[model samples]
Target chain A: MSVSAASSRLPGTVAIGRRRVSVELKQFFRDRNSAVFNFAFPMVLLVIFGSVFGGQEVAPGISFAQYFVAGMIASGVLYTSFQNLAIAIPLEREDGTLKRLQGTPMPKASYFIGKAATVFVTYGAQVVILVAVGVAFYDIRLPSTALQWFTFLWASVLGLIACTLCGLAFSVVPKTGRGASAVVTPIVLVLQFTSGVFFVFTQLPQWMQVFSSLFPLKWLAQAMRSVFLPDSAAAGEVSGSWELGLCAGMLALWCVIGLVLALVFFRWTKQGTT
Target chain B: MSVRDVRKSYGDLHALDGATFSIEMGECFALLGPNGAGKTTITEILEGYRRRDSGEAQVLGIDPARGDRVWRSQLGIVLQTDRDLGDLTVAEAVRHFAGYYPDPRDPDDVIDSVGLTSKRRSRNEKLSGGQRRRLDVALGLIGRPRVLFLDEPTTGFDPEARREFWTLIDGLKAEGTTILLTTHYLEEAQHLADRVAVISRGRVLACDTPDRLGGRERSSARVSWIEDGVRVETQTMSPTTVVLELAQRLGGDVPGLEVHRETLEDIYLSMLDDDRDEEAGESA
Candidate 1:
């Protein structure tokens, strides 16, 4: 057969993207380790922390468990969307799977869209599960009003996009599949610890607080807090404010910056000399 | 596919130093060489996976350096290393990759063609080396590619599996798929390729049909026989003339008469040795 005859029959981008999503989702579900880590791990952490410090008040009237719920949700988004993608991309490249994909007719955008869809679905499920656990087990309140739900929706969307893009960008850091976890795990751990995922943002040291505020994780957590916590709980945050606009602005900025970084750094194959 | 004056350099090392070759449609051409002989460099260039520093390369009438998804869709590539899709079954992986192409073969048929029907449901990670190699071929063929690139496709296959793979490739060739293969296995080149290009040190020493490669057919043949209970052998350009003279002297069938031409491996080894000698002289 001639190349033109074959090329003329190439599948469209959308069809390929949809198939890629289904394939990626199937692969994700089959891997029990990743499924549990991305979905159950956040809820497990929420349970562990919520049980230990559920009674204490972090803010004037809000209990520690209620305050921590927002941060945990934020952490789940970052871990499932950003951290997972960052680690998976380099590992795939190292293992020649990315090269195989590159050899196909699928466009690069379709691959990323498929990956983004997988992250969004996984993180959406994580949020639902974590919120259910918080409301049932920790007596944490859900987003009550239309405005609160609206804030939650945009915050989750923006956070997921920023994190996933950052993850794609960071894929350049790991040279091999074996080194991906080593490179990505510590960064995730440090981000979680310092970005108020585990502790109150106001309580951390000034320098740590300032440093953490610069990252998307901190802004995401603060945004989530504004949606879930009562206005009175704002006193516990830095600047004694919810800073919803600032939160949205920072995430938007990160989205733009992360996209640019991913485009510049993301490679389908490992660096070859020739 | 056509490549002319292709050159790729990594730092001070020239991976491909002006190597050139071409393959006609429906032809199975093999780039035969040893490890580090730039067989992969040439294949990757044609596969559109890597860019050459300086070269002219056109695969399927398109410059591989600028090959897009549509161009890529027409090509099937099986890399030397295995591409395991984590926990996906062989069938699942094949089916998934099939969706990437416009016109893909039936996944089951492709799996069966590679003789992986029994292990279709088995996770790719669970497959043995040879089985995994078969899965690679299945993935490569699922797209119904016009041009296929097999890079050391049988590297990990057992002898039986290797022979099975040869038969599978024979089927592909019979269907008129344009195939460009690279291998260190001379026998594989001899068995599969319509033409074999002997590459060494990033250069094509010779490119011709397997029987004619390195002038193997015209090169001196070794004539051997038993004479008065003692073995005798002579290298002669005309084995027929030598045998005729031997028969005339013996006045009957020459005892244990045997005339042997060099195998493809012998010619290939000599080409590599000649490369080494030239390198040694250059260094001196």
Candidate 2:
């Protein structure tokens, strides 16, 4: 007998990708503890840092809160894309979620695409909330020109891709799910401190400035600063100019590196792990 | 599906040492063994979840190690132990899995078939052990799989639940779906399998119909009777001859006569013991 009454043609990747995204979203939001913490932590940081430094000015008119808003946007993208996946993926692996998916007919690419899409949606919402908070309470200004908005768009998307890939690569480090947050949160915290998300990049110790430049966070924050802060404020940056091209280039480069590392390190089953 | 001389080793431990078995279409084939007897190893290889060190294996006319997404869609797996999808409700999990197939059964129908319709709206973690297993079966059936792999599917089930699960599998067998089952329960194999392979020490010791596994049908039967206020018992290859001789000696009617043949469990245990003895001799 035939397998079924319906057509036997396999569903397209697009169909499965969309379904996966919806399922991922549902799973994410349904877990109230994680949903609350993941979305709230970044905004909470923006409030605390914005309040402490709201009165200071770095470029004659740009308050520290305004400056901090740019860094927070960059940092928010990292939280949603990198930190979230780094913790979540390992947990799924430990729970046999990845193994279950591997046994299915879903194309492997669609699984990653679903994750990327979920990151994009959640990161997009995070940016909106961060921008709204910046404008309402921190006296931060929105980008005035279409070019600035365009810059905002590309910078966020590139950073999200880079971080998401990096997160997938980094997920293999934690031996078990219970220890993932303990390991992952510290690395993200360190990146935030050194990458100008929590402090002015130029004022950080010279060694930190040199070290953070190698990673995506510094470039992401710099790119965000270029769009949100005035053109005149670019002089205050460590490079003495808004190196938009370099920001894009470094992030693009990290995307490649992250992809290669993820391909090499990702394990679908615990038995495959070292 | 067929496996020829499949071998897998973890360092010094031979998980599947040249094990071989072939399952015909529409057949309920059971792999019976004790723990660490390579049942899960061979099943995982056929499911494409693991690669064999060296051998030839295929499922649905394709090499499982190289099986692609389309090849995967035609198969279903109920794992030995998995706690995934705990966050999704029963219906949600079934429907989500159904979307992965090109042609899938109706999600609600599959859920009902597994007897999990009552827990449809409950989260997977909320279900009892037996209920969770039923949900696993629901997900396995949602894709209308032509071949289903059930690895110790009812390991934690109560006796009543096990019977219900057997009935469910019987229904699948009726529908002509090829089922590959691995279990420690000999009765489960006897009740559901068309054929059973008794595996021990990473080898196929015997493969035949459940009734004839390890020559159980031809093996000696115990003939016992009450004679002269004493109980008498003897094992014989031909119980008819022994019973007739006893009746003739006892004047045509033997009191408390009883004939007993070896059960599948008895045959299976002896096979395992013999295998262990062989291993001990080799090591010495």
Candidate 3:
């Protein structure tokens, strides 16, 4: 059928990309445990961190709870986007679902869109969880100004995109679902630690901080912290500028590279791998 | 329909090497081959699933290699794997997929045609294996496809179900739907195919009517009969002449006489064996 005519009744479009997204969403909700892990695991991590560092101070100025809340929220950016992609993409590729869809008239890019859509929803859930827990337990207040909230919101969203791109890129290398955790878990933990997802970036060594800056994690964390914490508090977090625009630029660059790698190298079959 | 000199490979392994074949507008062409003999690669190429390194192939006057989206709407593919629709009833999944086609068969009619009406409302995952196969056939047909490619369509089917599937295929053939079946079941090919092609090592060894395949039908008829408490048999091209001579000798009809012609399976297995022996000798 003509693409136009074929899309006539497409739930979105019969494009393989749209089909992939829909099926992912369908299966995502069907597996209650999967949804729980995607949406709830971060909160569980939040509780653990919150209780452990409840009264202690990470720095002379920053309360452990305050610092870790933002760090945990930033980790949501990785957990929601990266964790989802790492688990879903390789599993789908292994299960022959990708191979099955290749036979259709759906374009290759459509599959990516489907994957991105699921990550987007999962991230949305993570955002709600992060904000709810931060406010309820840790006193991690929302920005006083709407503009600050917008900054936090946009920064958080951008972080998700960046991590998602990295995740999709990461998924292309794992040969099987078992290897997926091995491939994704380590890089995620490294990025998490270096990006200040679990600790204060300022306390790390100068070279370590520089290396962290090279990644989008630190940028996303710094930008997000600027909104979630008081303006007075962020003064101790980064430099005068913190290169906010450069942070966006670098993240966008990773987004482009990750996307390109995902598009080019991702194999739906073991045909070549085998 | 034509697939001209197509070559497809995955990594170091060549799947199809300049494989060429064609089917007419209203012909049932059976692709007979042992497992992993490149029948699937060729079919996938025709279905516009896999890209070939070199070839010019066409289905219904449109080149499958470059067939646009509209061309695919006219085709149907029955996969070996069944659909995985958990909650949706048989009618629901069929109705859902039917919406994708520009011209879809009525879901109810397709269900009935596949003999699934009694279980139409039941959830798809609850159906028996045979019923599920019927559902797959129904889904393949719901698109009102012009050229239906059935890959091992009757697989996992019991004897009765196999016969029913053949009848369904014949019904589709009567409706002028050009059916292409790739099967290991020689009986299925003998019963359903108007022309059968035996493929080995990514090449077509022979393509002809089942009756004429390997000269099985016209080569000779083997006749066995009872005479004087003993059984006698003769192999001759002219069975009627041999029967007449035997009748004269016995002074009546040959008792317990039976004439046998080689089955498609016999010829196919022998052809495959010969190809293997030749390969062995050449390797040695």
Candidate 4:
């Protein structure tokens, strides 16, 4: 037999992908900055916001702190899953890490799946911590029924997937690792404010409300509100209803579009000519 | 592996005009060139990292441009720049890369072979530049590749580190690994490569064994000696005849006699100079 034929067979794609996820998670934990930003920063935001606005009432019965908890959770999902990936992917591409992995036998799909898996794990843990903080210190209530819990589960899963996919799609915007923060930070800030993460949605101007609705952040915030807030608290929302169906549909649409864009534009190297 | 009439261009710049070469299995072939000579363009095309505009590149009996994961698994690559998996220890990094291969060498053994056994527990970020390079080699070798592509592998290495790297490469050659190396270091080419291809401006100027490159073996030799306390030097097509004549004239051994031939560096530089002059003439 020829030398090539004599060599061992290539491993399965899923097996290598699992290894890539393990390796990526190991590296993620080692980066203390990312650890704090993805896992701890959201809980800190929850405490700060809950303390300042916990007394004010958003509706007849629900307090502003209770309403803000759902928004904060939505912002946490976007920050950990989307904003983090937007910056990290570009940085990795600039530093030649993506190129190195491309040269390996591991499939490109596996590389992306590994990154998505890391986001899910880290962001999932952050969600758990935020829920604990909301319940323990802030008098925030959990979903009382199995049906509400199911709604919460699907919203969280779909929201995470949508934001993470958008992050991957935006990875090509930054020219270098140093520029990633400059490109992503302003967008995240604008999204948080316009989506009513801090202010009441009904208080924002109609134009700003329409503008925010163009992106996924507002819908994600609405989705979380549907799960966490009592049904009467919907009066404070832009439409006086949760619009849970619309929220899920928008998130799923963004997921499809983002997945397609990422697959098309994702780069292994910083420059096209090289 | 063979590359024939390969052509690649970036806008108006021809990164690879037309490069052609081949490597026999188990032979160490060096692509010797200066910076921006298209050595990287050729190497990347063969590695399947980049595509060629027009050419035939067959690596391990398969076209690299269309090669699959199975084809990729058979080749090892040590890039010019460092690949950062800096958070992991040396052993962890090596073992992680090992998982990508079908049948990989033991990670511990690979690390030891690269002389990084002592640094196995150290994080990649903490290792020095030379040590990082050794780790790169270890990662490349763990795949147990039949062919290895090393692009300027010792560019930033210290003299001691360079020599040590040469020893490690020698061991790989002895184990029958086909190595395709590119470097501007002529001495490295002379020491390690069984055959050398001199490239300049996206073109192959000449390809031959290091000793016979540019017809150096048949070229004139420089004979230097001391006569009447004065040093004299002359170039001769036959150094033996010159030496005999000098011995007869001196009636004994010539004082401070030395015979010098064209070194690999001398021939390589002159070849590049000649190519540049020819291009200048053509453009004029």
Candidate 5:
């Protein structure tokens, strides 16, 4: 088995990829700044929003805190996948990490896989923490049925994939590590406010609703609402009913777009130096 | 490994213009050059990190442009200056790199070879500049590569540390690991290289053993003597003839007779100066 595997053209690809993921995760969590920003910031946002508007009802028999939990979870996935990656990737390129890895025998695809895995692990942890806080502090409701829980899992997976790919693609927008946050933060903040994460979709202006529909975050928010909110609450959506199928389709389309963009934009090193 | 007629350019500035050289297996070859002499450009092209606009480069019978991961596995490259792996401890970083190779040396042994065993548990960010460079060497060596490329490997090392590094490299050479080194330090080349190549303005000015580079062994020697309470110096292709004549003329012992052949540093500087003058004349 060892001889045959060694003779193959791409030997030990999976084993090396696993090693890369472990190394990437070790580096990511060891950095205090990344730990605080990617893991804790979203929880803080959820709490402040819950405290300010926890009691009011966005729909009949549904409290604002319940509705906001679904939105917060969706945006939290975006923060872990998109915002974190956009900053980390450029920083790696600037600091010679990518260049160092490029010289080694590790396969090129393994590097991106390592980064995606880090994002997934961090996103999973963030979700658990946010849900625990919502249930304990604000009495937020979870999916009540097996099918509802299945929707939550699938929606989270798709949303995370789309957001992660978008983050990798946007990594090239910043020329240096110092410019990464300045370039990526405003785009994420604007999307969150427009995509019904901070406010109800129908409550926003008509132009904002149309604009948010073009992106994945709006669909992610709607999918989370379908899981947590009662069926009657769907009447308050722009279409007056839950649109789970459309949400899945839109998120999947963004996944394709994001993958293409990432392939096109990703570079292993800074422009001039080898 | 060999490079022939390799040329690369950025707009109007030619980074490498038809630079050519070759290294024999198990031979320690040092590339000596002033800054911006295309040494880095050529080295990067050979390492498969940069593409040449036009040239042919072969390492271990494989074209670097077409080198795959398997091909890369056979070579080790130490970059000039890198701040990577700063978050990981020295041992962790070395062990992590060791995983990338098919057959790797023991990470702990490699770390000890680079003299970082005491700092094994310390984060790379806390290492001094010289220590960080040693870690880079440890990572490069962990793969037990057949050919090693070291780019200014001892830039930040003090004199004692540099001597230690030389001993380590000498051991690798004895083990038949081919080394292609680029450095600005002439004494380093004289000590480590079996043959040295001097590059200037993207072209090789001279290439030979340390004793014979720029025809140092055959060049004119400066012969000086004290006569009539005055020092007199003359350049002679044969210092022995001059010394014998001076002794005979002075009757007994010739006062303060000195014969000086050019040092490696002297020849290297003059070669660069001559290349600059030639380029200046052409442009003018």
Candidate 6:
């Protein structure tokens, strides 16, 4: 019986996961300041970026609010995946919190599952909040059909996977807590800005636009826009089925890469390999 | 539990260089070392956390490098660092881990054993330093592991807390649980270990009963007594024989006489000094 197998026989994965969720929620939203960070901060950024931008030119016709809403939610993936995972994962590793858990017969998968689950559920709520604000304050419309909402959800999931993978890879190089934010911050900032979440990619210089397409951020934002915005309008950033397939494929590839790094570097003892 | 010539390296650094040791069923074995002495490397290999670079290791009849469900089920590990549940109470945390093992002890019983029953409902992060250490032991023992590994189990404890923790470990020893412990504190090693091994720089210097290592038992002892109201002292190879002679001269209890040989700590410190001298010599 392997460690994972031994852990499989245990019933505490879901129970522990539930406990971890309750604990994280309280810790992350314990105060008024935290509430601002978790909820209002992102909405404020959306407003600032959405209004201040000069209008974009797109071949497909769409409402500006519809286009901007998806981009805002893609930014939510940025908040949930890269920024969120980077801070939490490095802190856990530095304080030896993860080391302590590894010795227990707890299934290792539950740790990742618990973390990703919290991010997904919390960010899910944040997405609703962002969308609600978009509708109430910015006149953004709801998807006209169920299919569009489903597509938006699927695209968000892909973006989450890709960004999380990148975060995990980036976490490997940050050996200490104080230095970790410095290492992960620049990459996150550049990726977030270039991915077209804050602005349209085509309007950038041609060379910069080419560089942005290589990252999952642009593809994810592009895919997300395809879902939430009406196809009849030519106002969206991404154009065809080929771009959507490429985004999904690239995100899946990054998932494999992230999981591999996480497994190899995982430590569960007083002495850590990392 | 047996580990044979296990070796591990961290890039150019050799963390565990052919380290080999084991604890029989129901035995208490202590590993002693400084900060970077590879004690952790060897113990981690036994815990199935880090991969061994070379050689075979068996923990509870399974190779830890490939320990299975039953293998993992039979062993428990207590890390040097404490775990965080943030808001989960002590009882809740212990109960949570108890669900992971097939033959786990009762959560309440384990909590009481570690002297954390009063703090059972208190959030883990709210516990005092000693209280948290007790909670750490409670989680380790919850699984009723056949072999328990305790790494520097009581580093931040006060004198009273340390004594209480020792009593708890003695209770575990009485139950036939094998304990493999690593510690930096010499007094801690002397107090709890049935036998001790001193290692430095990725190698084991010696392994024996506390009184037997490094020619410890046969070394000359210091005898002190008040003779005719004047304090007198002498050194002798045999503490018991000296005491007997003093008894004969005094015609009874040997008038304030005491024969004291070097303690386990004395032996341990000498070993450490030897290590420093060797390093200095090599550099010179």
Best by lDDT: 2
- For all candidates, the clash counts are 0, 0, 6, 0, 0, 11
* CAPRI band for model 1: medium
Docking quality of model 6: it rates as: acceptable
lDDT of 3 by residue, B1-284 (tens): 78777887778776776777778888999999998789998887788766778878888787676775566667888777754554467887677667556678899999998889999889776898889888878878987888999999888889988887888888999999998889989999999999998888777888889999888777777999998889888888999888899889988877999988787888999999998998799779
lDDT digits (tens) for residues A1-274 of candidate 6: 4455655556566765665565556555543443575578788876765566413433444445566677778777877777777766776777767776667666666666667776777688889898888777766767778767776777788778766766665566677755776777677678767776665655667777788877677777777776666665434343534266677787777677766866675443325554
lDDT of 4 by residue, B1-284 (tens): 99999999989999898899999999999998888999998999999888899989999899988877887787898888875888889999999889889889999889988889999999998999889888888878888898999988887789988998999999999999999999989999999999999998899999999999999999999999999899999999999999999999999999999999999999999999999999899889
Q: Considering every candidate listed, which one attains the maximal DockQ?
A: 1
* Candidate 1 vs candidate 2, DockQ winner: 1
Estimate, for each residue in A1-274, the C-alpha lDDT of model 3 and write its tens digit: 4556654643335344555666567667766657777777778877888888756765465566677666766777777788778776787666545654554434556667877788888777777887788779877666688867777777776777777877876777787866787777787789778877777787787887888878777777777766666666756766754456776787777677767876676566656421
Query: Distance (Å) between predicted and true CA of B252, model 3?
Result: 9.5
User: Lowest lDDT 10-mer window, candidate 4 chain A?
Assistant: A1-10
Question: TM-scores for all candidates?
Answer: 0.94, 0.93, 0.85, 0.94, 0.93, 0.84
- What level of docking quality does candidate 4 show? medium
Which clashing pairs does model 5 show? Answer: none
Error of 4 at B51 (Å): 1.6
Worst 10 residues of 3 chain B by lDDT: B79-88
Higher-DockQ candidate of 4 and 5: 4
What candidate 2 gets wrong by more than 4 Å, as runs, is A1-8, B223-259
State the DockQ, from 0 to 1, for candidate 5. Answer: 0.48
Tell how far residue B205 is off in model 4, in angstroms.
Answer: 0.6
RMSD of 6: 4.2
Q: Candidate 5, residue B148: CA error in Å?
A: 0.9
DockQ of each: 0.63, 0.53, 0.19, 0.55, 0.48, 0.32
**On a 0 to 100 scale, what is the lDDT of residue B189 in model 2?**
94
Evaluated at residue B129, the lDDT of candidate 1 is 85
TM-score of chain A of 5: 0.94
> Which scores better on DockQ, 5 or 6?
5
